[model samples]
Target: MSHRPRTAEAIWQAADLPARRLAGVALNPTAGTDVLLGLLACDSAAVRMTLCRDRDLPEEVVNAVLTHPDHRTRSFFAANPHIDPAQRARLVDDAHWLVRARLAQGPGFSHGRSELPEHTVVRILTTYDREHLDTLYRQVPRSARWTFPSHPEPKVRAFACDWWSELTPRERSALLADPDEEVREHALRNGRDLDPEYVERVLPDRACHARTHLLMHGALSRRVVEQVLAAPVGREDLAMIAGNPSLPLDVLALLARDPDPQVRETVAGRPELTAEQRRALATDTDSAVRTRISVHPALTEEERAAIDYRVSSDETFGRFDIPARMYDPARSRHYALSGHPLLRRRAAHDPGLPPDLVARLSCDADPGVRVLLAQNHPQAPAELLLDSFLAYTGRERWSLTTRPNFPTEDLAGYAGAADPMVRRLALLSPQTPPGTVAQLSADPDPDVRADAARHPRLSPRRLVELLDDEELAHEAAANPALPPPVLDRLVAALDG
Candidate 1:
């Protein structure tokens, strides 16, 4: 046999190794980009890790490989810190899990649950490992120690707040270093809101932190956030501070060019944002910036149309987080008409359904669309909600039963209805009352009995009086809230 190597197999094999391992040991500095790119282009996902490791690669070449149609190519870019915000934003909604997983690491990404993909969140919180969290936030000091008091998500900042007090000054500066106004505000808030000395701890350029803390606690002059915004020295830092509801218009303009779409979003999200701000963000080159404008309920159709213009390309849509817009009744209808399935899915999630649209969509061909409307309390018609419950039966018992908002009383009545799932939801409805739980205790389905048996609000004494059944007795005892006196009665019943 000839000694010539199989290039394709070699490329594919190279892609199977861990990205860090591939990036480590420098696979021979003398090797050509062709070998590197060939492995990057391989069928294996492992290539992404290696491509991210190459710091010496040219920017255009890196961008080209990043922008490659394959998701793995983009994954490499997300892992590469050198990729800028605009380019990094390109991977925000990449089709492959690994690509988005990689993107989650970049410094500016994943600020809120609103932007987080569901699977990624599941992976981050439930994966039983901090690898993904660490991968995305390796550069961020104590990624779990997110500080910066003004952050819109209170819990994350609070956790960070507790962590911040424990850190050195360099760590404190990282908390305020981001261009976010909330980050500044949080740092200003440092141990105490009223103390000026606490405010002195923030980095000088992002003095909006200290200023915002003072103004928030009513310790400083009016328009302190605005004053910071107008300062030429920290205009970028101040616009974020000015993002506070209390900041004036001129101050917000100073933050207008902030590289972060989220800052722009914060400005757009404010119902009171001015016409000039709307125009600027609506025309922003980034679709996310434009999506922020598009999702706003206050925008005129003409203004929204301008945003629609920027959204023509699929690339632009990836940068958009349309679900935020879908909650708006007016914009949701617009999204429902969009060509994208995901946007339509979001629109379908809106609680408000016009009577005619509601009627038409009750039989929507898409199961997810039908299911979403069933879940929406505001727009979903009562009849549709009921129909949706009845329509779901043996399909998946847990899905219908788990919804916290299903109409319990009405569902209880529907126990006599066709669908077992409907009957189950009806029985479990919070409003099912003691009367309904009693009735369903002896129902034919074990699952239904189990649900009632386990309900914390239901009295185990009621369970004994009602169930007169064996398995139900064990479940009723499990509830710690069940009065101990009830256990005595349960034991008496067993004795009988």
Candidate 2:
């Protein structure tokens, strides 16, 4: 006979998440407080919100509901005017949450009055959460706008940046100069384009600002970028200028002499440069600069070989994750191979490729490339991965193997593979049979043996019997789901 669930209100009542979700579609406002309390106090959120709507709930019940840790219940009690204003203000700091808020303000608004008549504005300003940005779109100056730019939270300062149109230009300038970098960056990244005068003033004067840093480093606007290039001040300042995509042919020639290969490489990649500029970069003292010319989309394959390749640049930080916003084909091109192996390692996992490109990368002799490939290629073929696993496991080693999904048939053969990394991986797979897991537990590799000992199919008695195997028992104990008494007995067995 099929088993029936007991305790209709217990955990078993809902067989799955969907059933749990459907259990409280509607709430009874007039329901007795007993049922209301049971639902509101439950771990099940559906039951809590449903019970919070009881209109006839006793004032004490409503008041107690406000103290609940759940945001929705506190929000409900906040809307219920029955809660006293003084009590609501106190709730703002309520270890739970402040339930009382402004209801008298026009449609779609809620403001909590401060204790002091005049200081309410300050209180409202202090309470704002900038991430919930839409909430501030319509509130009045006294209610939602914070006049200060130095708020402790940059997100709140970011919110203040949106109110630029309403503030005086001086106030806007003050925000641009705000000490918080994210506040300045967010303002420029999203707000209306800054006037050229403001842009110039901000870039040089606000040199410490992160947006200015990005602007000097990778600015897109032509006129603004040219100005930074003309004012070559320092290596860092020069790096910022050359990094801009708007560099001209004449400017690229000047920058190609930069002591930093990183700076010269940026100039070499610009399409705006003439053929002479490209040809000049081909022989530029820095190997990285020449590499840029060879790999540039505009270069012909014939040009790549004709230009003598020299290795000059030793860039350590050239590799980075593929930018999510890299729509330009040039942004994704990889021409300069870095000497630093770590840089090449990160580049291997970047999801920047079509499947074919990743497959081509698999042939890369760098073991780190192989490892990164196994770790990150979202579309990595199972066949290629199985072969790699078989090859590595046959060596019987433990190491920095990137997690790769292997085929089922290959997993059985891998149990005997010499590499513990490969053997441990096989034991870890969900598809491995209980018998296979048990068999692998007795393998020579301590790691593979440990995983087998901790396998869910292993009985507590069996686990207790294996207490003499220190590493296996220790690994099994790390599984918190294992019974405390069983674990305690096993640990005690160490000495016994």
Candidate 3:
């Protein structure tokens, strides 16, 4: 067999080692644009990595890589220092944490650099992190150290306390007396080496959540607890101490008999309470505390079930966690017909709700409940969707139009609706017939015309006509209907 030099495309797809290595290393800007585009789609990670560093790579090319299915590739694109801040912001909510992490390194709002303003640095650090925290800590401005101790996340606050000596006396005192209980708890645990002077100042403050946090830390002295109880403090503060697991039996007994019902309620829910304590609380005059004791784990299973039951409803729904059992066929039906509007509203939104219940709620007297049925009931009757369309406006109307499996044929009239947004969405529907798209191609609203220009069914000549329109050209370029010859001419025009 006669040997001839293989073309770049042949080597780009070659099975041989030397040929593929040459393909990646030798690839450069001078290569044909189509060849570069083809190589950009190569299966090899090495080739992709090599292409990202090319000096002549255009911003348009980098933006195109953002849509690559491989997260690593998208992340590489995001980490490019030159990546536009606006482009980088698009990846912040990406599903993969690594992609967001890469975007964080860019110049925009990630506080990625050490040189950003201190307030901006402090604001960005409030969100939790794993990899970025330690690196960011060394770079954090000394002036910004005061704010982290009261940060919403306990871990971040704890991290800040690791360098406690750097904070001023006022900062230390403020952290100790912080209103958020978790921040105070972290301070007591992590600020052990700090001067006791701050603690002395925090101890005298009447309303600080720090007292209960100190109780949690086993650092509260008997004298301090006594002083707090005697201080003419509000019952809410007393209730917090009453709930403390490490509280002494003597103080617990005193609080158990406290005149305040909230204090009694707090003590009733204490996990460390003995069976004897629970039994004592069971007889309390407060019915709410009695109910708490019935369900308390300190009572035996039989004892818990033995309590006198009431048919009346609890004003505050317990937990409201909406467990899986709430979705059971029988339970959902019961809730759907209940007199309580909230229960009926919840049932109206339940996906597994019985079809008959869906029909009932569709015409619910409460418009909010009816809207819930309209949004969530997948099997909603056509008349209900139509009525929902006519009955609602603004977001509710827009929301109804976007429902999955929406009969697009029903949207045909909306193409000319008074609301331009409604008309745009109607025109964008996959089921919008060809004739409607053709008609909207000349829509007076530029936005509607832009959407029509990008429609996959748009004719090739119409796409060519949009080529010179800067607003629609990019979208028109993305239309797969454009012929290769047209793409050649478009590229030629751009180069000229």
Candidate 4:
């Protein structure tokens, strides 16, 4: 028999209903002030949290909820605009740091009308949530932006660096010279018209990442570059300069043969290389350098084919579809045996790789090549599959478990694995023992239990047991194993 739909009054009168259900009822326009006032006394934090943010909450109700012991409840209440200015001011000194921080960052605190004492300003600036600082920026005064760059807190100074437009040239220069690296980096990056003399001063002392940003931002000077190169810096320092696209062709040539293969490789890919320079690099001993030179636009078709024996560059990789097929048999065989794991890893997925070579990759020391072999090779060994599953716990395990006709021998082991997702896939597998499904139905994680609830082999009795679980009830009720009468009861319970 069909029961009548619950009316608002009936829902309110049903005091035993879950607090979350009552919270939803409180949102309805028909819930009278008496019903709302009664809900304010609810023991559920979730219900009180919802009511705390309600704009239409009566002053008396707001006052009552304000005294709620839960910090989260009071935090949401403090966020409500209806709180009087006097009360809002008092809330800044609330026992909870977050509650006070929220009020300090609120509009009234930053709008010049509510002046936070210097100590309170320092406290909020140091401890307030970083996520809310972007919103706080707009509410803060123009004059106050100057104080933060020099603030004792690094985070406060770093954040204040963003408001560069508000700072005078002297303040900007001071931040540029800030003793803290992050503060100086932020100032240099965001501050405009950075003095060339200042840029030169920081070049040698600045970190590599800072130098990269400086180059990218067009802040580097020719004099600074010459000074750094003239001094005995490491190859890494030179390599960084070589990578900059703005470097002159003469400097690129000088660095091209700079002893370090890495430095030469960085120079080889420079778009400014002349045809002669490209031809010179084609014969360089470093395969990495030759690989980059092979794709240079200046190289003739013949030059590209001569060095085409190896696949080492992104352009070379891009030329082929999956199961790469461009290399010669000897080259493919060479890569399969190459000591370098990078080549062996690439060859694992090469369709042209000889069957013997492909099989050899199964024992590759690098797990990545084995992972590729497992996913692409039809006859991949069981050890390779299992090893990849346990070693690389990324999404590949899920893919391996769900692949059609995956070996039944592996299913049992995975069915008992500690990872919930691995067990979840096992529960969905046809080969998973019925006993395992029954055990997983009671797994602590709701999602794992939900997966078990949807299994086709689940017993009707087990499905019935899950009908009252708030998280899994819907999935359990829909289980094909559920008996018709039990399903009807579940649907009715869920409806109410």
Candidate 5:
């Protein structure tokens, strides 16, 4: 057989190597517009995702993804967190509903970035059906919600009415009398939660989620409570009634003594619990009920300490750390000073804690409290960030390094640390020596090696050597330290 040199195009067109080649090229920050455009021609979905979804693309590549024949590729681009929201919003009117829905959901993991443009938000609200609207509603930025009630689009106005409880009296009145029937109806339905008669009429006879909502959140008349009690309610219904703020003292006392421990647990959470009720539930047979009472705001720290309450490590952190616009600093301060560690964990989620509270919680015995503080507070101590990063390996572990106060001054000292994650931190330090970068490039841990390969401190000669390295090629190409001439030549070969 005659031997011929393989062309770059042939290598990229090959079945087995294309995915690797495409990934390496896609990750190359120095890859020019032409090279990126060339990679888009590759039919591999993984390549497309790596190209369009993983990193911010050049304008030409973004345009190509916008018009790509594959809707799935377009969908991936739609949810990409790296791109501008306006760029993602371009897909709002996509021919495919799935693509539009993805656009409506905004970026998959926004780290407090800007929201979609107001006009784009209105366009999605007007076009999306109920199912897509529900998804879009959750992702809508809190800043946008305040303005939605005044939006010119009726659909947007109506969408705002869904949060009627949050609206000011004036905004509610305007929506109720708005010309648009749909907007008016949404306001009426949500506002009716305050109407004792309406709640009584709509309260379902059976135990359903809607009934639970009414029993727990709706304004309950004495008659409504009596009617609910008259029915043979389930454990859930009793629990919901126990939690209702409007529950009469007699009913509250009745539920406190209910046979189901869950009902007593809910009663323990009621803000209206009498001194006697509190004393009684603090020693309830159920540990969960006692635990619930242990953190009651009404109790003194000394009183809370006296209760034999147990805090589960599992309940310490998870969704509690997610940023919420409505998070109250006062409430967080209350929790931060509470005797219970679980409440302290919740308090640590507040980003605006006073310097005193921050200092106090940074030394909290609970690891979750410290980690939550590190994850949320902008001014979280550098030591706390490093400590949390080393200790916690749960969701958003990488987020700890992104904190504003995350220490980078002496991270190179961790290069020889036993933990691979600690070893990876060495690459983040500006003071890391080139020799350490080169040494870590051959680390046994794939993640540490990949991160080291992408460090700008890696020697030019070694960076070029890694271009042929299958495992490290993509990460090496992403390194900004690659020489211009070497990068141009690589792009030229890939462009072919």
Candidate 6:
């Protein structure tokens, strides 16, 4: 039974249609620059959000957004992940502080590659007031920090002074005497507060995390240590104190035998652990304590294997989804070949794995190993990414599709696959036919149907029918194939 397509008048007369039509058009990949430019004047918050934030804009549209009257519209573009970071970086000096802050925060989802230009970062650090500067500082990648101390920008060099404790003495001295007043001030500010006398004077009055910071990184005097040991701190604080490098050998031994398994676990990783302490912790009653000791640098492989440590197959790897710091290739290589799947999984977290190891791990029997590799490695094989996407339903599942090597060609074959999720992949393929897309628009699965509804190739007759469909109207309206006459009518009806 064939039905005639809805008239533009009928769609215009439909109840509550304007917002949906505008939203859909905003997402329509085929929406021309002129259509988008018309939309920019529509003054609907929902329309503005969808238009500015949801997809990459044309150069003309991007320019429109850059100078958009509404701050929210500009702010949304600042955080739009689909655009190049350079586009987002341009907003660093925007008139609105909120827009600049959004740019500082980077994209909402951390694929781990988005970063502001170094010049922009320097400008924000130098010119932004303290509150906004703090926001930018937190988003700065740890890998880039190494260059900060030597950067030509004084503000960047001053930024490195925040990690005063980690700097070499030579670096510290140089920064303290830096020609830039701000850089020298920052070095002095961080260095002065960590002195033993300053720590001792402030130890008793400091809060828990503040005290923990002093204990862990600040210069700790005997009085401060004694004060901390006598305080009624919780297990977390005790665990933190156990890992303090400045702790005396006697204190380290005492903490290794602490009743709390967590504190013992913390003490087990200490470099100062005596041979006897290591042996005792290896046989600790708690499995986690034993596992911690098993990886201690002092232990021989034979000794490490001798300990009955546990590695759960159900262990979550969410933290390892994105590489946070520079990984050591030597250590990653060693772990990649280890007998334990947990060790192999750890190795997969390294994004810079050698090609050979990447190939070897791609075939690992453990699902975690393959998924982690797919998530972390830049050159993860396309087949592995597709396989991982199909097999894993974790929160980060959709991220697989965004990977550089994820296959986009010849995916129409998945349209008829039994799994609805796999069917969705067909819509991703440019080669998928309009007939197949229309068929999927009526698919049993709502997700598959929704994806099909937005597909650019969907037939115009069905697209108009979907605009009147409550379930698919928003998606159908978003279809790039929605005719120019229909789009013009929908925009014209906006005032009514």
Query: Best-fitting candidate, measured by TM-score?
Result: 6
lDDT of 4: 0.62
Q: Estimate, for each residue in 1-496, the C-alpha lDDT of model 2 and write its tens digit.
A: 4243223245423333322221221132223355446545656543443344323355666667767866555654433333344443334443422232321111242222212222332344456443322443433344344444546655556766766656677767766777878788766754434444454545553456655455654434556656556664445665666756544556667877767788878777776767877887888887767766765557666777676564322222112333334433333235214333333454565655566557765766655555455545656566656555544432222322333444444355567667676677666555676677778878887778877776665555565555444345434443433555654443332233
Model 5, TM vs. native:
0.80
TM-scores, each model vs. reference: 0.32, 0.45, 0.41, 0.40, 0.80, 0.81
Error of 5 at 322 (Å): 6.5
lDDT of 1 by residue, 1-496 (tens): 4243234245445542223223321232433465455545544444444455334455555666766887545665665544444455455556666666565665344222223333333334333233545543332333244333334453344325444546677756655564656555666556454343443333244445544444434322333443454563543444345345545556567556677666676666566767777788788877666776676657655656556433331111111212333467776677666444335556666555466655655566655555565654345555555555555433432443334444445455765655455556765566667767766666788877766765655655675443334445434544443565554443333224
| Higher-scoring candidate on TM-score, 2 or 4 | 2
lDDT per residue (tens digit) for residues 335-415 in model 3: 687554545666766766777888788777765566666666667666676566655563445556555545555566778
Ranking by TM-score: 6, 5, 2, 3, 4, 1
Q: Compose the digit string of candidate 5's lDDT tens values, residues 1-496.
A: 3244333355345534436645666877777787788777766666666787778887888999999998777887887878887898888889987688677766644434437777777888887787876656645766886789888888889999888878899999999999999999998988998888999888888878898899889999989888767775675777887888778899999999998999899999988889999999999989999999988889998889999998765532433435545578889888998868979987888877889999999999988898889988889999999998888877677778988999988889899999888898998897899999999999999999888888988999999888778777767777878887877766555545
TM for candidate 6 is: 0.81
After superposing candidate 1 on the true structure, give the runs of residues whose Cα lies further than 4 Å from its correct spot: 1-223, 226-240, 271-274, 308-383, 386-449, 452-496
The Cα error of candidate 5 at residue 157, in Å, is 1.8
Candidate with better lDDT, 1 vs 2: 2
- Score each candidate by Cα lDDT: 0.51, 0.51, 0.59, 0.62, 0.81, 0.80
Q: Considering lDDT, which of the candidate structures 2 and 6 is the better prediction for this target? A: 6
Candidate 6 C-alpha lDDT tens digits along 373-442 = 8988889999999999888877777778877899988999999999888899999987899999999999
Higher-ranked by lDDT: 3 or 5: 5
| lDDT pick, better of 4 and 6 | 6
Q: In order, how many clashes per candidate?
A: 11, 8, 0, 0, 0, 1
RMSD of candidates 1 onward, in order: 23.6, 16.0, 16.8, 16.4, 6.5, 7.3
